[model samples]
Target: MAEDLHEIVARALMLDRSAITDDLKYNSIPEWDSVAHMALIAELEAAYDVMLDTDDIVAMSSVGTIREILKKYDVEA
Candidate 1:
């Protein structure tokens, strides 16, 4: 499940799975700019079948935070 999440993030951000670390945040990585953030959100929502709220989208700063936000939608990490 975790690997699936990593893959989704990596693909959305155009990064390698190895590059996706817990500390990886929206603006922390170059590929994770605003545009990429939106793409990532879309990918995650589609993959998990959950629509993230605007607040959750803004709060999804890091990989850890993303996991926590996903939990709110009942998407296990």
Candidate 2:
């Protein structure tokens, strides 16, 4: 599941899987800007088959935070 998360993020951001890390945060890099953040949210929802609420979406500012938010939907990483 961790690998899946990394791949999804990489795909959404047009980044290599190797570029993704636990410390990676939204808007921290060129590829993870606001546009990519929305794309990422869509990817995560599709991949996990879970619809994120606006609060969850807003809280998904980092990889670690994403994991936490997914957990709230019972989508464990």
The candidate maximizing TM-score is 2
Candidate 1 — which pairs collide? none
Residue-pair clash count for candidate 1: 0
Candidate 1: list runs displaced more than 4 Å: 1-3
Considering summed lDDT, which 10 consecutive residues are worst modelled in model 2?
1-10
User: Can you write out model 1's per-residue Cα lDDT over 1-77, one digit (the tens) per residue?
Assistant: 43478889999999989998877878976899999999999999899988889999999999989998898888986
TM-score of 1: 0.92
TM-score of each: 0.92, 0.93
* The best candidate in terms of lDDT: 2
Q: Please estimate how well model 1 matches the true structure, expressed as its whole-model Cα lDDT.
A: 0.88
